[model samples]
Target: MIRPDSFVPSARLAPSADALLFIFQEGRLLLREDGTLPQGHVEDFSVDLVNPLGMLDGRPVFGARLVGEVPTGFMLRPLRGVYGTLSEDLFGLAGYAMQIVEWDRTHRFCGACATPTVRSERETSKVCPNCGLTAYPRVAPVVMVLVTRGEGRDRELLLARGPHFAPGMYSALAGFVEPSETLEHACHREVREEVGVEITGLRYRFSQPWPFPHSLMIAFTAEYAGGDLALQPEEIEDAGWYRVGSLPTLPPPFSIARRLIETVAQGE
Candidate 1:
């Protein structure tokens, strides 16, 4: 429901009334001592660096990097921890800001010529001074699939837990889309590699912007065709089919994995 009218990015620092200041340090977002976004005069924070993100509704938004000691009334918060605590619009904007800041920080130098790069005047990119190589923010696409089998009372969903997931929490199979591979191909390959199963009727569901480090998650619902569970030792900790009556812990509500499961569970 939180939709921005348009995105107009700028490299210059311009503060306005409706401008949002996204200050980050060591990969954590800075918030007020009362756990709220800083909304007053921008000069109070003593920001050292600022990058204009875009315009939302009609106001400019900026991303800042804090250099000095933490401000008197500000605190650092982990980006993931602020997901459900912040409004959807604000959270989405924060994700965008983080990605932009990271891209700027990492691409300060050119990869090919080993020379310092400068920001592009006309776009959100870094141009090499010597080689003229342009580097844009990287967005990795990942595929997620919720596999189901049977119908009526016997219906079951296949869920798997990655090694990094919280204890007892399981979600759909997912993998990064390999270069030169189609999304559908990535979907089929992930299912086979993770759980050793072949999926049929791969139907596209939806996509979500996941900013753990810039991942666009594309979800799907696939019918379980054949093969047994042969979990990938390195990636998958456990996997199984669960009936509606008995399901394990799931990912957070803000995540697309939970939505994909809920949509099929509710017969939507």
Candidate 2:
């Protein structure tokens, strides 16, 4: 918010007079009406949760969730909606801030010993005083698969519509990675469970951090091997293999699912 062009910044620095703030209400970030980060004084607002979000251009960046009504000149907006409106670095900082704020708000006590936890000075974690156990923020990893078969113009993609997806929209098959399971195994399991299909050639692609709460999406491309198109009625409403020329409504461009489809489908 300070927009300092120079200075060394760190995640856990002593707050300075020129510190920048990222405020949120409910789960939405506080911004100006034109969708820029708020740079105004917030000493008047009551905060529900607050935590450091590292540094930007030499200023300590802190995140806070405001209590009660929205402040006078500022507005509350969903973090996703202001993607392009913010600088790439600032956008990432905002998402990370949200996760930290939520982690601090929820992990006030140790889960094991029921003792109040103390903040770690050098790390973003809570240390239990009684048990000496440390609790760090959790990032759940999810696997996304874009199943394909055939080649060239004959190539097709397996897309499915979730129960809550917009009407006529479809995307890649995805599921969270369970404990002790590998990414490859999660990919196969998600596709099989969601659509009852077997796949091969599990090619790992890029990943994206979706911080609605906290989720790391690892994407891959798999070739259809076997199994019929059996939708998991509750999770998936409809599914089918789609060719490039005839595709349904896809996800937003910001999502890894959409990027994964585009990487394979190319011209689509």
Candidate 3:
């Protein structure tokens, strides 16, 4: 998990000799040939907007979207493609940058009154000058639960694959938290709705900031309480209990879902 206080977040920035920039174009990040963030002043590139992303390693960092041609030796790749190539801190910053760009782009106008919104000078938010409405970079919280049964080397884990998952890949069950619901409720409801089962001893695990479009995955472990495999066709393509060595292709290690699985099913 990325530390939330890794750096002192600032609402302003001024590119200089030591500044680092995380620039994106159409949600794709710009990484250099050696897989690193661009550093120093970015005067050569035409940027649509630049937002401060706090201070890192005593260097000012900024996030922006490119309007100019891609710089030579710098490839525009999806953030997912740069997962293992960049440092954990850099990946976190990239996720932050992606979310900021999306928030700024989509919230140019007020949702309630349709008035143009202005970036807050005091913090990371946008304000509608007319209605006092404010918008911040928001993260939708999702719960990922890995259900387990039995114990030790013979321990079995309940895993499933979504319709959109890669071939033969399976991961923990997950769903978004709905309004007026607790995280625990969301977790149990998701498991029951998707697999027609109940889980107990819901143990809280770590979380990961997944930025496909700004979601915080809260992972957990639970004991199988009851019910049989009755997969919800619309949500789950397949689901079943499997031993560690027989597990299918799981989610990438960087994801919280993967961590939850590895925490219990450590072998193989």
Which parts of model 3 are misplaced by more than 4 Å? 1-5
Over 1-268, each residue of candidate 1 has an lDDT whose tens digit, in order, gives 1224465556664667656778888779999887777764466676744677777666777787788789787899998788777778888788888888888888889999889998887888989989999999998999999999989768899999988999989999999999899999999999999999999999999998887888899999999999999999999999999996678999988889999998888777
* Ordered list by TM-score, greatest first: 3, 1, 2
Q: Give the poorly placed runs of model 1, Cα more than 4 Å off.
A: 1-3, 6-13, 40-49
The candidate 1 region of ten consecutive residues with least summed lDDT is: 1-10
What would the TM-scores of all predictions be?
0.93, 0.91, 0.94
Residue 6 deviation, candidate 1, in Å? 5.7
Clashing pairs in 1: none
What is the C-alpha lDDT profile of model 3 across 164-210, one tens digit per residue? 99999999899999999999999999999999999999989788888
lDDT to native, each model: 0.85, 0.82, 0.86
Model 2, CA-based lDDT = 0.82
TM-score of 3: 0.94
